[model samples]
Each structure stands twice: as C-alpha cells, then as structure tokens.
Target: MTTDAPVSAEQQRREEELVERVLRSFDGCADPRLATVMRSLTRHLHAFLREVRLTEQEWEAAIAFLTAAGHITDDRRQEFILLSDVLGASMQTIAINNEAVGSATEATVFGPFFVEDSPEISIGGDIANGATGQPCWVEGTVTDTTGRPVPGARIEVWEADDDGFYDVQYDDGRTAARAHLFSDAEGRYALWGITPTPYPIPADGPVGGLLEAVGRSPLRAAHLHFMVTAPRCRRLVTHIFVRGDDLLDRDSVFGVKESLVKDFVTQPAGTPTPDGRVVDGSWSRARFDIVLATEEEQR
Candidate 1:
C-alpha cells in the first residue's frame, strides 16, 4: 500500500522554470499577434533542445554554420535561401501556402537567380540574346480559371543557358536568356529562348558544403521560370519542367510539380519557325497555357 502525496508549484524543475521565464518575456510585446507567435516559437525551440538533448559543442557548430552561410550571402547570391531549400524549409512553406486550386497554375519557388527590371521583348522576339543553345519557341496563352482570355497580361520569363549558368553568373555583366512580354488581344504570347538545361546550384559555398555532408546532389531539373500577372488575377510564379528530365524525381529544391511538365517538341533543321524566323539548325517548341486565380480566390 502507498500513501498519496500532492506536489507543490515550488517543485518545478530548472528546465521548466527557464521555459516559463522565456514565455513571460513575451508578455510585454506590443503586438498581440507577435506575442502569440513569440510564445509559440519559444515553446517549440525549447522543446526541440530538450528533445535533442543538444550539447554545447553541437550548438556552437550550428551557430558557426549559420554564420558562414550569412558571410557568403550577398546582393547576387542568397546562401540563406539555398540553406532553406536544402533543409526543405522553403518547399514546406511553399506547400503550406500554395495548395492546389481548380486549374490555376501551380506555384513554385522564386529561385535565387531572379532579378528585377528584366528587359521587355515583343511577341516573337528572342530572349536568348545570343546565348549558346539550340533555339526554342515558347508559345502560350493567359486565361482565367473560367477559361476566359486575359488580354494584356504581363509574363516575365527566364532560364539558364545550355551551359547551365544564368546571365548574372558570368563576369561580363550582360543580360541574356530572359525577357518580359505582353499578351496579345487574344491572350496569345510567344518568344524564343534557349532550351532548358540542368544545372547545379553554386557549389563553392556553405550550402554546397552542407549538401556534400548529407550526400545530396545540388542539381535542379531543366525548366523555364515564369511570373504572370493580370489586372484582376493573382500573380503567379511557377516553372515549366522539361519532359523526361532525369532530375525531375529528385529536384534539389523540391520545386517540381507534375502539372507543370510539358513536351518540348523537336523540329529538324530548315523547318520554318512560327514567326518565319530563319533557322540553320535543329530547334524545339513548347506550348504552355497559364490559368490565373481571381482576386477573390486569392483571398
């Protein structure tokens, strides 16, 4: 037989007291929502430490790794984003925020290479700008989920060259392989660009070290990035992966979606382009139709 005894609040352990102190620190936060988030973050972080029974050496190593990531980051390179991508944080956030909705194009990561103020091009113009690769004709239409055409829509497109490097990666500082175009009265748009090619993320940095440590490849599948916008539709950022890409099953950033893959039909040399442009060698063509979610749907 055992006698029952009541425990007092004074019996709280040191770990429990520390957690309570951190939570109490959030009490003075001016914003209620921020306070709520801080409270949750404090609880989760402390719990993680407890669960892992993390040692001081491990904590210091983590701090050093993050510091190195920050040191390598700059205006053109985003080491933090690469870190988040490799850690699956970026993709997880994207998944939580962009659940699939009826026929609206699926969203993906706005990758590290994106830059503001890309040059605009007319329909049928070439965005490759002499980048080395086989010519590819990309034609598509912008429409709403209801199947109505979205005239005057703006579409920004960018891709890596055959060598798997973006325009910004070169020391020359000249832009190529990217352009912005407007939809026609019938919502049709077309432009010429280089065929998409697989490329590894910058491997000379801390993110690369982390990938190597974990035995993860830094290669992303071949794809074309697009940012489409219309007056009443939500802005869509996405990618169209090349069909039959070997890396589709293992995109380093976890950015691929089945609906976004499309066929890039090969055309032999001497075939007339849709816009009657002269081509001396083999070329390719792909057609992708974009559907936008309405403002209400976005809300």
Candidate 2:
C-alpha cells in the first residue's frame, strides 16, 4: 500500500480555479434549473475530491465502474437506478418531492422492476398469475386526506416471487406477479398475490460489486409495490412492508417508512378466505388503507 503525498498550497489553489472554471462553463446553459444543478454538482464533486484526496488511479477505477454499469443497462434492467438506490440518492429525491401532507401515504423509491402495460385484474383477481409463492389476500381503500373516498383510483401492484425473482427476470415474455386494477365504487380494492419475501436487489452487476466492496447487504425487506392515481390527486408510489421483516431496518434501498409497515396475518389450512377462495395450505392477509393528498394540498 502506498501513501498519498501531501497536497501543496499551490495545488489546492489550482484545484479551486479548475472547479470555478467548470462551474462557469455552465453559465451559458439556457435552462436556469440546469445551470443551477450543474454549478452545485461541480462544487460538491470538487469538494468531495479534495476531501478524499482522490488519486488518479482511484478516478480511473471510478470511470471503469461506471462504464461497467452502463454496459449492463438495457430495457429490462437499469444499473444506474440500482446505483442510486444503494447510495440513498433515490430515497432522498423521493423525500424531497413527496413531502408529508396531513397523513398522506409516504412515498418511496420506485424500484426499477416496474413495467408499463401490466395486465389488468379485477377486484379479488389473482395477480400472482402462476408465479410461485404462498397465496396472499390484499385489501385496501383509497381516499383523500379529508377521509372522503376517491372512487375509480387505479392501483398498480407488483412483487418478486418466493424465490426472489420478478417475472421480468425470466425473459420468457411472461407477465406474472404484477397487474393494475381500479378501485370499486366504494374506493375499496382487493386482490390475490403471493406473500412477499425478502430478496436481494440484482447482484450480478456493478452495483453488487460496489455493495460488496463497501460491506453492505443488498437485501430488501418483504413488501408489495403500489402506485395509486386518481383525479386531482398527487400520484402515490409506495410500498407496504411486512411488519416483522428483519430487514425492515436495513432495506437495501432505504425505502421503508414506519407508517407503511403493516401486519400480514397468517391463516392456516382450512381457514376460509374473504372471497370464499380455496387454498391448498396456509396463506396470509394484509390491509393497507391509502390516503392521497390532493394536487392543491400537495402544492
């Protein structure tokens, strides 16, 4: 192991001048927001480099890592989002954009697994769609903060199967364990899904290597994804974590909120499901009442 040489006063001054030059380069940006973001990013990036006394070798290594991340990203996977999630950047952005509004459900990181045009299911329909896992019954209601029901809200739900694999990972063009459904006239929604199990974020790529180098676990807690939208309300993208999941305190994405943890009551064999559906063995049930902030309230 080699030690870094002490930084000289002249070297520090030159570094500062270089940072200012980079920031000034963005002054001509037509977009005010873009200009501001670039200036701040330059300042912080330079500061970090100075604080760490980053070496040329380290910089080269960082570039190589980013190149690997880019190489692996495709329509089915997003390595950059995984990088953001593990670094807490995604959660921070979510917190900034999703300020609490009088008991409105809190937002969390929108994991990269989400897809468009998920098959639509009706109330009490099974989203599992042949995905392998124990059956789960999910019931919920959507309402505005004032306690009034918001009928016709669209709810999109998805989760990994028991083996910690989403349908998208299979490459078979199959759509399972994900679906969209509309809330009924009473603003109530119910569906059948598999019990969510703890799973690691994709670990076969550069993000996984970074986590390993930093001694971090890639495991996310058991939870179900939900994106709800209704007329004149702020869209809510969130998750309901299983109450007793051990990983709740250390979700890899840092997405858990205490209010979003809910009990998933277990039912042994012979217990009757709410909709008179039959299960071969044990199953579970969970209820999540979601409240959304109106657009005006969100503002």
Candidate 3:
C-alpha cells in the first residue's frame, strides 16, 4: 500500500485521467465556449483539491453547502451572487475584467440588486419613491476626457434605505431606492433618494455559514449603486461609497475602491441650491464623476 505522503504515481495518473474523462464528455457539445470553460474549471478545481489535500469530509461539506445555496435561489433573489461575494470571487472576476480609466471613472461589481426593465426617470427625479428615510441628494456630471458632455447617457442607480434593507427584502411589492435616468441636453444630474445604510449581504443561507466558519464579518458599508452607459463610452457598473463610513474598509465583498469614495457634505440650512435640490434644513450632497473608456467591453 502506498503511504499517505502526497499521492502515488498511479494515483496522480488516475487524477489526470479523471480530469480527461470529464473533458471528454463535452465532445459534440453545441456550445464550444462553454465546453472550454468547463474543461478549464474542472482541471483547475481538481488540481487545487489535490494540491491542498482536501479531506473527504471537507469536500462533502462543500457539496452540501452548494446544494443549500441552489435550494435558496429562486425567483426573487440570487444566492449564488451572495456566495460569490462572500468568497471574494465576484470582486476578483470584476477585477479581472475591470476597465482601465485614466481620466474616466472605473467600473466595479454589478451587485445582484438591479432588476430588469426599470422605469426611465428624469435627471432630478426622486427615486426614493417617497419611502420614509433621511433626505440625501446626489449630483454628478457625465463627461469625457475633453470636458465634453456625454448627453443621452443612461444612469441606473439603486440602494438600500436607512434601515439597511432593500425593498425586495421587505416584500413590499414595489421597487424602492431604484431608478433609471437619462442625462438631459447637458451631462448633469441630481438624484434624490433615501440615505443609505450598511446592510449585511444575504446571510441566512449557506453563505452565512461559510462566513461564520471563516471568522469573517459580512457587513457591507453604506453606498449608492450606479450603472452608467453611453454610446461610444465605457459602461460603468459600480458604487459610490460614503466617505468616513465606519465599515468602508471592511466591506465583506472587497468592493471598495479609494477613487470611488466621496465625502457626503452636509449643506447648512437655507443654502442656495439647485431647483428640487436642498430645501430648508440641513441636507447632504455627494459629487462623483464617471469616466468612460473608449475601448469599452472586455475582450
């Protein structure tokens, strides 16, 4: 019998053969791209397990957790994104395909909050849907490197209310703190919404169990999500984090970028402001600029 050192030469050959067998099943597959991806994933996954000497019980536990993750996924939410986020895989994938922007704003994770077919709104329209929460006004401009306005750019923004919960989580049968807006004749916009609050990613499923096992906290700092796109410009899908937030550095998904952080300045009462902007008492403002890349889309 071979000692439990690493693996016998025969065992190594068997492992390689097992990987080959799995790849061979993809023969005559319609989607060649998917086949290639499956092959790569299988090869790397098998090799990693072997290299790490994953125990049988650990492998079973992983499988059980994955089964639970799939069971939790349904029509309303995506538990897989939550799993990937907690494992930092989602951010790593985004980083690999992240756009390069010297003068433009960079792209980040398109978290699982956005839904399909949001109502189109005007530049200064309030997206809070009149939900009860603190008043926050976010304003920004969409322009290129030459300071030219990128008119007609669509800006999609969403975030959780002050209670640190998305409307989808509340079963309210409505979309809260979400809106899709197109820039007017100019590249300016002022969005009004509820003040954001730090929220824990879906932690009731297998993902939460994984976090517990790793001794990691799953708190994501408060931030507003935005997805901006324009013809001939790089599409941005990211978040603008509140500067000085306590959980900024400890984002469970590792999605915080220093460039994306901005100060939420408090405007004193009765200050001169734009129409439909700040009114009587104290208000807050966040100014952000999204830079679009000419060479958009990952190849």
Candidate 4:
C-alpha cells in the first residue's frame, strides 16, 4: 500500500516557529479578551496567507486597496462598512450575535447611512421632509415576546428616496426621508413615509471597484430600516423588505431574511387612512409588528 511521507522535522519546526512568534508578540496584552482575539486573528490570518501562497505584490495591492477605501471615507460615507458588507463579514457577525428567539424580529445589517438625532414626529405625521416618492403609511405594534405591550418604545426609521439616495448623499447636509417615533401607551405606532425602492449601495469607492472586479451587482433590495428599543428589552436593528422586490433574492449585502419580508399594499388616490390622513394619489401601506426579546431571553 502506498503511504504519504511524514513531514520533515526542520519544515515542521519552521512552521510552528512562525506561528509561535506571532502569538508571543501579543503575550503582553493586558486585556484578556483582547489577547484572545488577537491570538486567534493571528492564527487564521497566517493560515490564510500560507494557504494562498500570497506574494509580496499581492500583499502590497491589498494594502493599497484598503488605503484607498479609507481615503474615501468621510462624515457622510463609510467605505469600511461597505467593504465589510460586501465581504459577508457584517452579516456573519450579526448572525453570530443575533440568534432567533421567541418570535422576535430577526436582526439585519445596520447600513452605513444611519444618522443620530433624527427629527421626531407624532403618529400619522409625515416623515417625507421634502424628498419625493410615493407616500407610504407604516404602522405597527411594539410588543414583548409573550404578546404583552411594550409601551413607550422608541422606533427610528430611515430609507433611501425614490432616486436611490439617502439624505446624507445630498451636498446641502439636509435631513429627509427619516424620522423617530414612539409607541403609545397601548404599544401602537404609525407614521407616514415614502415607499421603499430597490437601490444600489454607494459604488464610487474601492469597495465598488472590488465588486466590479468580482462581477457582482451592487443592488440592495427595497426595504425600510427600523431600530426598535424598549425598557428592559433587547434592541432590534432590522429591515422590512418589499415582498416582491426583484433584488430580494440576491441582496448585495445578504441582509434579506424571509421573516422580514412584508407586503406593501397599494391604494389608489383618495383612499382614506385610519388616522384621517389625506392622500392625493396612489400610495402604499405596510404593517410591520416588532417583537422584542426580553432581557432574560437575550441572556
């Protein structure tokens, strides 16, 4: 019978020595968690380099690409997040931390466009704030896993305009197409906004070049981002995608989840809304109930 030859002592020693040297470099890390993370990262990174037989030119090119990505990042744009999203690292990290539990809404990527201190509006108030699109009504309840109401929960929402651009994309630094609303005493919430439409993630930077090189499309499925938080409950960062958006099957960032898809029922002009809001033309409505995991469940 044929058998493989054993690794020579000299070669095995050299391989071990390389890894050991890297680990030893982090031996003085004061934080236990940081040390563990750095050690693990070193092992995998070295393994990847060895397995690919990476050349010096390739390493230099990778460094240059990362540097370019950083150069394009600014207050309004986040190229590193775009890179992580395209590489599936963002989604993988979310999956590791957000396991399903008790029918709570499944979490998804918090895209790079989110901004703090969005203007607050009451239920049935409009959040369009000048940006144009087909008006949409979003209504929902914030409830605990056991069907109990989570009164006074905060719900922050944001979405791209019909032109496939977020508020931050504008040069004037104005806010539009986003709002912050709170649930009432009965855990009910509603607000008016624009219907979501399929859009491409920003593609003018190094990450975009990488996507083009790999023959991948940069389109993200139509969806509205929601961040719901309540007392003593886990905060949920998720998106409610349009049920029939063509891009749903192949979201560029792989953020689409079956549980998060919902129907956006279209209504013709003059349709009356529950909150007595007037509609001048065709509009859409989406009902998305958020189930928040309790503190205990999160543990």
- Write one digit per residue (lDDT tens) for candidate 4, span 78-189: 8999999999999999999888887899999999989999999998888899988999999989999999999999999999999999999888988999999999999999
Rank by TM-score (best first): 2, 4, 1, 3
Write the residue-wise lDDT of candidate 2 on 147-206 in tens digits.
Answer: 999899999999999999999999788899999999998899999999999999999999
Instruction: Rate residue 107 of model 2 by lDDT.
Output: 94
Clashing residue pairs in candidate 2 (N, C-alpha, C atoms within 3 angstroms): none
TM-score of 4: 0.94
Question: Per-residue lDDT tens digits of candidate 1, residues 19-51?
Answer: 999999988899999999999999999888766
- Candidate closest to the true structure, highest lDDT: 2
For model 3, residues 1-299, the per-residue Cα lDDT tens digits are 22246677998899889888988988878998998898889889988887877888888998898899899999877889888887789888877777455676766678877877777777778888856566678888888866788888899988888777777778758877888998767788778876667888878888888898889888898889999888987678889988888998889888898889988887788766566464657767778876666544344
Top of the candidates by TM-score: 2
Point out the higher-scoring one by TM-score: 1 or 3.
1
Question: For candidate 1, which ten residues in a row score worst on lDDT?
Answer: 1-10
lDDT on C-alpha atoms for all candidate structures: 0.90, 0.94, 0.80, 0.91
Preferred candidate (lDDT higher): 2 or 4: 2
List runs of model 1 lying over 4 Å from the truth: 1-12
The TM-scores of all predictions, comma-separated, are 0.93, 0.97, 0.88, 0.94
What residue runs in model 4 are displaced by over 4 Å at the alpha carbon?
A: 1-13
